[model samples]
Target: MNVAPNNHKTGKEADTASVANYRVDNFTRLVTYSPRFLLMLLILPVLSGLVSVLLPAFGWAPALEQTRFGVQGFMALWQTPGLTQMIGLSVTSGFISTLLAFLMTLMILAAFFNSVWLNRIERLFSPILVIPHAAAAIAVGFLIAPSGMFSRLISPWLSNWELAPQGILPHDAYGISIILGLTLKEMPFLLLMALGVLAQPELGKKLRQQHKVALNLGYYPMTAFFKVVLPNLYPLLRLPLFAILAYASASVEIPLILGPNTPPTLAVAIVQWFNDVDLNLRIKASAGAVLQLVLTAGLLVLWLAGEKLVKVLCNNSITNGRRKYHDKVWQTATIGLTIVILGFVLLALIGLFLWSVAGYWRFPATLPEQFVLLHFQNSFMQMSTPLFNTLTIGFITTLFAITLTLLCLESEQLTTKAISPFTHLIIYLPLIVPSIAFLFGLVWLQQLLNNQTAFLNVAFTHLLFVLPYTFLSLSSSYRRLDPRFANVAASLGATPSKIFFQVKLPQLFAPILIAVALGLAVSFGQYLPTLLAGGGRIATITTEAVTLANGASRRTSAVYAMIQMVLPLIGFALAWILPKYWFKGAKA
Candidate 1:
């Protein structure tokens, strides 16, 4: 009788194990092939956009009733005034800004790689990242403008001038101001990427060991980092550097604000062409878009060549076997640059706040004569619609992006297979390609498809940009999570889905929130995508701010820019605060 009962119990246990295995296998099969399909979905739009633009460049657009393909568009593009100057400006500004940001990133790492100062700088990254590019450009312009805050602070005491000085600071011919603005924005990104790499436990330990070995050999700390650690670190940074180069080369917003007007950068000029009342200019604009694409690619190629040159040049120093050199000057300079760059950003933001409330403020006064909410009150009625649209799009775009990213990452974990290198490149396509190039084409294609301008279309376009950033933000934390927790849960009869939701998701709450904030920021900063995708029907704070920035009303523009800056900051704050409160409640 006892033998019979024991046998029945064993049979029941076996059945349970079999069912669990079946569920796990079913889940694995479902997600295994999803990535390939998702990759196609992501790539098709970019390819279609490129094709749509290509036909117009050849003077063939059926919508325009000119099906004959020829070189008319290219010829018109070449004939445009200041064409050469626009291309030259784009190339120079892109290269100079990227180079400066990269060097500064290295200097900061060398000076305070594992120190408290480094930690402090890292803390400031969130605020800087939250500030939209348009807002930042406006703030930077105000702070550095000839009669702006910096000048007012030093005028009577040092310069002895009462009236605002006439100087072409922000809109200088060579685009110096554009470069400064780009550098301030790009450094945080590059530094963040580097820090992520350094934060990997195994890699960080190895780097520490290598750093120590070099120091023991009598090499100075800074020199040791360049010779030993940089070779490893730089390869990982190559993709981000390329992405930065692409943006700096063809960016429309900063250039629109700070670039010369006689002939803006190629990208900016293309926008003007597309927006012109003369419809024939659309074909020319298409050609310019194609040229801008080629220009950005050429810039990347040149950057690659520069990379080789730098490697060879640095290799000579490594061979010299120099043990010690005076690094104090270099360290001091690094610290000073860090302070100036951070100070400039802080003061620029403050300048925006002051301008928003100033009443009859003059050039030589650091403070407004009398602060008032008159500007805000005047702008509120106009600002209401754009603010609603911005929030709606930002939330919708972020939600979908986070969901898709989670699926992709979860699929990776389930299959125990990472995406191939080629697939990874495809995901980064939206970022590496200049938005002006494909977006210009996409706008025309949307018209051809009779796709109405709506929030869904705008959100979809925003997803193309937002998804990559979201994945990058959350992937590291997700992948590094311990497997034991899942194993233990599975042993308790949990299904794959259950472990994913209850076991894994809870552990990843903070990172998920962070990714959400990053997605919102990326969406909020989009200017061209929103304007083009929505066919000018959609007005986000970014688009409105950019428009107002170019207008004569500084106070009204400040009001819009301030709103743009605040939305992302609010997202980041929620990400930080929610986790603490939720976990505290759980503990209680």
Candidate 2:
């Protein structure tokens, strides 16, 4: 009887082991395949979108009844008036703005590394990072236009003029305004990306140690950062740098607001062509879209060349090992410039708020005549539907984006394999490719399949952009979560799913929520995706704000812009507040 009992116990144990092994194998398979699925999901749409544009560029659009393939679209695009100027403006504004933003970012990092100044900068610039491009453009317009707040602040005092200046301040001939606006918006992004990378505990410690070594070796702080830190740092930042370059090259909203009208940047011109009344312009627009892709790619190539040249030129200076290369003067200048740039952003925001509440404000006045809620009161009703749509889209997009990001991160843990570089590129494709190029084609595909699902369609499109940011925001923290927690959970007989939900997730709650806020911010800022994918069937705060911004109603535009700006701020606030309360109960 004892022998029988022992055999039965052994059989039961074997069965249990078999079941556990099966589960483990299954989970591993799922995890291993998840990245592949993500890559397919991201790549296929981009390819289809590209193909959709390509067909029309070659004159093959059945919707327009031109089914034959030819180069007429390209010919038409070539012959467009002031085409050369458009190209030149796009190249100049894109390249110069990106270069300026990048240089400013490097300067700030070199000047303030491992100091309280760096922390102060991080705190200040974080909020600016959330402001939508369209809203920022509007803010910049209010701040810098001839009749803008800055001009008024200086009028009849510094310059002795009672009236607004007549020269082109915003829509200047050389596209300087576009460059300034883009730089204001982009520099914060590069700063944040660099900061995030440096915030990694291990990497930051190593970098700090290296800096100390450089200091001991008689290198100036800035020069040490350049010689020791930047060489290592720049490679890590290559992807984000490329993203900034691509965005600066082909962004539509800022250029639309501030670029020259005679020959706007090729991006704005392409948008105009697409929206033109004549259907023939659609084909030409497709061709222009292709050209936009080419132009952006060319800009990237130029930037790469510049990188090589800079490396060659700096090689000697780097090796010379000077103790002090005017470090204090350089630091003060960079710090001053950083404050000025951030101050411009802050003043721009204040300008938006001031305009929203101003009543009968006149020129040369520092403050408004009266701060009234009339604009808000009058515009509240108009804002209702768009606000609702914005919230809905942002929530839906954020939820799915967070879910997908968490899943991808969890899968990495389960499989013990990091995503490959190719997969990384796929994730970044949306950011690096000019949205104007493929989004139109994607919209066309959506129309053919079923445009009636505008809400879902728009959310999905937002996901394309939002997911990348979401993943990037959350991945570092997710990966950095101590593995021992999971190991302990596993030892305690928790299933992978259970451990993921109970242990890993609770620990990652703060970062996940921050990622949620960032995803929402990204969704709220989307203009082309929402506009193109929604097919004008659905309106969001972004669309409404952009529309008002383009119109003559600055006050109304400010109201919409304020609402747009506030939504993301609200998301961030909740992200901050919820974590404190959420864990308080758990801790108790």
Candidate 3:
């Protein structure tokens, strides 16, 4: 009996031990994998936005007011007379801009599908994508302002009547100018992202094959693109579309320049509240920010729902007899509108260039009365320090982002099972959420950490923005790389580090360079974060450009805008050139 009892106890204990060991092994794997997992979890920078917006919305901000908390702030926000109109402006502008951009992108893609003009058009679109949004807005403002280039060009020739030299175009009570500006800035981004999506090898091959088959069946290219390619492309394009929608809804600077004073967009209103001399208004600003967030989030959800509906419709149509309609009207409209968009972009650039050199070129002058480099000369002298600071920050941020992205890619590759969606989410957190909302909380944190170095903090803040894009650009390339070479090299007794440096790095040098360049561009374009994190001590080209743009001197603003455009162009050029030099003999 004693032996039986002992054996039973031992068996039970062995089973328990086995269970405990399995738990321990699982915990060990989780703990070991937690860093990369945590990286993914960082996607909810939305939480930062909630914290920043909610506290202030509830009147809990110690910096602004001593009000403990109450419904008063929320009520105050609602009761504000122009609040409804402001919300209307934001929603309308955002939706319209995104809608126009989406249609234009679709049209452009449809029109140029597998044509000779496709390459040329894509090449032309590249520079437009690289131009910073704020700079583009400023350029558009210059081009359309009464005293701007358009007025100057047509003033003398038409009816011998001078351009009014005072009224704003499409910038009346409706905020249409804001919509136009945002569309102009966002369309190229959509196109570029579309290009990236279209470049996927499998998708491209499939699309090409489908196009050939459709063409052989006597289908028009546009019809084939719409019927065959759009369904595949839309899914890939969804994220960028969401990004545009969010941006349009929360945009501040563009509306500030072009939106009506009687009732600005929600973003502008929030900015005003934050900047209000009255401390009590900060609560209202917080409330406004919360409202803006809710509105944008709601739109995003709606967009996703619509996408699902469209997918279902498309899939169902495949099973049913869906008549293929070649809408030449749509094709004509798309081609015409795209030409106009391209024209405006070119006009904006030309207008900016002219303004940079214009001495006395005011309204009614077809050409500058006197062309001199004085504005550039003066602006460059004043902006030299800020330019240097921008470059330094951009370089450091890009370097860190590239290194982090490489590590992330390596981690993903080494570990299987999708490496956690959270990692990718975290990388993209900064893009979806509004910067201003989070920067407020970040400011509070900065104040708490009073002893920390400003430069380090600013760089860290920039990393939060740059890392996602760098990782995204590099991830696809990294995953596509063949492991056979590495395996062979390892079999030949090459060290891991040696193989990585000699083989992997050489193979990925071009993409890595492009990723770094993109990171540099993103960092350079940052405005809100730099201002908030630097404690107003560090000046960057973006900060200066915004400040100068707010000033009365169009000439000075033009100079800053040019610099903003030029820096990224230089980075892109370097990104292009370095790989060619470094991997001259290597087969792609």
Candidate 3 lDDT over residue span 1-588, tens digit each = 455444445778989867766765554454456556447435443475468568767767776545588866789999998888988888888888998899888889888887777778889888887787778878888878777767776777763556465575735678778988888888888887887777778988889788778777767777778778887788778777887898888887678766677877888777777666786786787777778878888888877887788778777654443335555777787778878878888998998888888888656776788999988888878887898888888889889777766655655544554555555555656777766666656655565567367777678688777877787788778877899988898799665445556877778988998888788888988876786678677898887887777755888888888989998999889989987867675544
Off by over 4 Å in 3: 1-41, 44-46, 62-67, 163-166, 308-329, 417-422, 451-453, 585-588
Q: What ranges in model 1 sit over 4 Å off?
A: 2-30
For all candidates in order, the CA lDDT equals: 0.87, 0.88, 0.76
Question: Hey, what RMSD does candidate 3 come out at?
Answer: 8.2
TM-score of 2: 0.96
TM-score of 3: 0.87
Candidate number with the higher TM-score (2 or 3): 2
Question: Which tens-of-lDDT digit does each residue in 165-230 have in candidate 1?
Answer: 997889999999999999998999999889988888888889879988998998888888887889
Lowest summed lDDT window (length 10), candidate 3:
37-46
TM-score between model 1 and native: 0.95
Write the candidate numbers in order of decreasing TM-score: 2, 1, 3
Highest lDDT among the candidates is held by which one? Answer: 2
Clashing pairs in 2: none
Give lDDT tens digits, candidate 2, residues 223-277.
8999999998998898998999888888888888777889888888887887778
- Model 2: weakest 10-residue lDDT segment is 1-10
